[model samples]
Target: MVAMPEPSAPLSLRHRLAQNLRRLRLERQWSQEDLAERSGLHHNQISMIERARSSVGIDIVEKLMAALGVRASDLLD
Candidate 1:
């Protein structure tokens, strides 16, 4: 079977979301480990989200927002 080629550019929303997550994490000087503990998510998952390597679900996003003291709109914007 032929493998699908990866896109040259990341999806706009995911890229923006990743940027916001990283900025928020850094603003508070919270490492991935801190976010993992606060969000009840795995450190790898937080890293994946910040790196735009994985799509996030509503529940996970909510957890992250709560941990970051941000709103969904703030993260999206």
Candidate 2:
């Protein structure tokens, strides 16, 4: 029988990005669906990204920046 490895802690970048995104969305009082519509992405995809289930690449980060009216640096914070 093979055993599965325990999940490691999330990377700081992932945690920072996810936290910043959530904070931004909440500041604007927008739902995941709202961000999805603005970014031309699926709601579930946004959910996944916010939850760090999906890796966020630069392209998606640019899209999110545009949708949220934030600079990429904002997410880094």
Evaluated at residue 66, the lDDT of candidate 2 is 99
lDDT of 1 by residue, 1-77 (tens): 22223577544777678889999898999899998999999999988888778898889889988998889988887
Clashes of 2: 0
- Predicted structure 1, TM vs. truth: 0.82
TM-score of every candidate relative to the true structure? 0.82, 0.82
Model 1 alpha-carbon miss at residue 1, Å: 22
Clashing pairs in 1: none
Model 2: per-residue Cα lDDT over 1-77, one tens digit each = 22223458544677678778989999999999999999988999888777766787899999999999989999877
lDDT of each: 0.83, 0.84
Off by over 4 Å in 1: 1-11
Name the runs in model 2 displaced over 4 angstroms: 1-11
Distance (Å) between predicted and true CA of 74, model 2?
A: 0.5
